[model samples]
Target: MSYSRRKFIQQSSRGVAGIGLLGTSALGVSLGAGSGHTEIEPGAFNFGVASGDPRQDRVIIWSHFQPAGQHSTPVQWQVALDEGMMDVVAEGIFVTTEARGNTIKVDVSGLLPGTTYFYQFRVEQAFSEVGRTRTAPEGDIDLARFAVISCSSYAHGYFNVYRILSERDDLDGVLHLGDYIYEYGQDEYDERSLRNERTLTPTHELISLTDYRRRYALYRLDADLQAVHRQHPFITVWDDHEFANDAFQDGAENHNEGEGEWRDRKAAARQAYFEWMPIRENRAGGISRTLRYGDLLELIMLDTRIEGRVAQPGGVDRQSEAQDFNRTLMGFEQEAWLQQQLSGTTARWKVIGQQVMMAQRYYIKLPDLFGGGASLWLDSWDGYAATRDRLLGHIRDHGIDNVVVLTGDVHSSFAADLSDNPYDANNYDRNSGIGSLAVEFVTPSITSPGFPPVLAETGAATIMAASPHIKYAELRQHGFILLTLNRDEARADWFYVADVLKRSTQYRLACSFLTRDKENRLVSV
Candidate 1:
């Protein structure tokens, strides 16, 4: 058979098999980490184990195996109630092959709601590290907490933020907004010091299946990234950097003719992402889905960058004309699906976990020599104002309450109130937040560089002075946001790591903001 034909068959087979592989049997519900398991050999399961997309009764567990042998190998997996794996509630045998990059992703089901479980993989006499994961709670959950993070570029700096988050015991899961990986070459986007300190394997831009796979493998080698994946289940969505810089549907700003066909590169990136991440295999084959935490929250993850976005026009100065072209950020189908989710969910909080910022972000006006008035960051929602209006308008028209948007991609933290017109004094009161429809919390990057201190401070002050709806902005930080939800309100606490150039656990809370159950605004805590 041809290579393409063989690849399709392999992918199809793996997809069908992995979609809903339940545990073979339930041994018991007790707890302990049995000492009887064989000692692990070096470099057996090199990538480690991870679990994600937690429902009330099911979650996806993942591992990659690369042992010297034949193309196919039989692996045994088990889930227990204790860290020791002595309980053995779920056990199964999954056959992995080189065809699927030697990666194993099993959607384990029949789990208890709102409970913690330990899991591990075994290949012959060797055992992988045991991972900890939790399922979402069932009816009437009073509280939920998740670590929101994004933009981890390997060449930028150390992943100390991931390590810090891994050490925390208060999280229910993780929300990775986007840019989980970058596609730039080692020297393309980093400084000389950074390139020498943390070198990429390929040393060139990723454009093929082999290239993308090797890049992911290199990142998985990080102890901090592996530690977080071992401890918490992550719900993830992709942004531009996952494929290439400023990626749209048909092509990317970073992709060129010399890099092969855009569709081929895109397919390569998508395949490798599925193979590595612990997210559940979508039968429909798209990265947009909704996860519910009983009546507390409904997390609607979106594919804003590539699902169906029309390529942005040439310059940022043409924003006024682009608005007339009727562009879409999340496309039509995704927009309809999101509308349905927002209108139907009875949960107290309707959390939209997406890539770019949704609130209006217009820069300060320049001098006449530089074409005068405020120019928008065309990549964000400011470029697709109509879609933002439609979505926020739907919430207002249908009387939907408690809508919170979690975003990343600007490498800065922000708290803003979503409004129909923040600039119009009649529509919204900056101090009172009268006409606000929803709220947004943007998380800083894990390691990607943000603006310098002076520029960040001045830019933030200018934006806030003109746009009162923006409550907070901290641009020169590399950390994650701890988002806590409850019956009364939703609070987001921003924490900044002490240093990203070196691996350190030192971090401090920069600030915090919260919105009451019925109010669609942010209040400083």
Candidate 2:
């Protein structure tokens, strides 16, 4: 992949200049009464623009501007086919208001597929840095490539992985499985030295729209994060931390009665997410939508948090009727939509953008003194066993081939084969194969404790020995995955950064996985 930073800058400057001057009334509206500062600081452009929800001929563009004051203003946005500004493709006017924290989103459409375009925003005559984005390929496309990223926590460490990813020009876009922002309070879980020690915006818990906005602003300020947004389009889905820890359909692990109601917190999180993210309004359902890359791939981005999820329990066995087969990660409507899309689509591969592990994990027998029981994360698919089984059943019943589940939120890496029937003890036997439903690749955290010696010393080893479906697992590393998809196969190279505690961009390929010819079987590469 090749990228030209200079080209990006030159095009962005031109787009900014073309927007012309901002009207005084608009300026007054944006800066509020008595604030004379109209020109924004150079650093104000630090949080770059991003594009997402790509289609064959359209894509959504996003950016947030912190004007001088608490007012509203109209911003001009332009999309061009070339970085040279020779052919202006799509241009529009959007209003940024205090209601939406000065954030602007535009859904630009009507262009050729599988093409690159440059975009920029002009607020009050001030131009933002240019960004490059691409649309998905049209029908009958031969290939598509994307980078899969997950678990980026600011306090844990630097986003050097994001920086390197931003420089890659070969990818069509990026798939972020979630945990884009952590909700930990200041000094709670700092991975590196507490240099920029600051509490999350709300200062308390984020249970309101204002709180969510503040949190997003803090995350957007990260240099590497901004760079990645500027460099390529991203298809994102939120995991637990975006709202509160272990968020379910109705409540969250971080929420309490006195703090606020779960509904209010969830609403605030969703609102802030929509306002700040480069996601398209759920045209079909909600955040979960399908993006097609010709007939080669269909990326089904799922909303596991906000939909029909059951309440998360403190322990694995705490059962409730809500956690039954009727309960769902995606509501009934979404489940039906997904099934319809999958059944009707002609795409060679079905890639699900999921938030947690889908593969089943069980305990290995051990002495009582050695902690015989397994530790099932109540927040993951393991908690929704029936739902997982149903989805796998659908894959098998429909003969859906080449289903790949891209997941995050465990703070660990895993490569596994999804089985139609997990209860089958002889799943590996060729005669009793149980039919492969899918293949899943789980990415580790950007900076979180993974399989630390303490965890290992406890009983993880025994659990690992019992779980055969999990072909490979790695804990205690922070990085991203580079995925390249060609006609015949899809390959992922796990890139690991040396250290997130210090500012270092060093990375190496830790491992690789490949699935070939719609087999849905992951082979070590």
User: What's the C-alpha lDDT at position 42 in model 1?
Assistant: 29
- Which lDDT value does model 2 have at 165? 84
Candidate 2 positional error at 491, Å: 2.1
Q: After superposition, how far is residue 59 of candidate 2 from its true place, in Å?
A: 1.1
Candidate 2 lDDT, tens digit per residue, 354-385? 89888766553233354322335646776665
Question: Worst lDDT window (10 residues) for model 1?
Answer: 5-14
Error of 2 at 287 (Å): 0.9
What's the residue-level lDDT of 505 in candidate 2? 77
| Candidate 1: regions farther than 4 A off | 1-43, 190-196, 315-317, 364-374
TM-score, structure 2 vs. true: 0.86
> What's the lDDT for all of these models?
0.81, 0.71
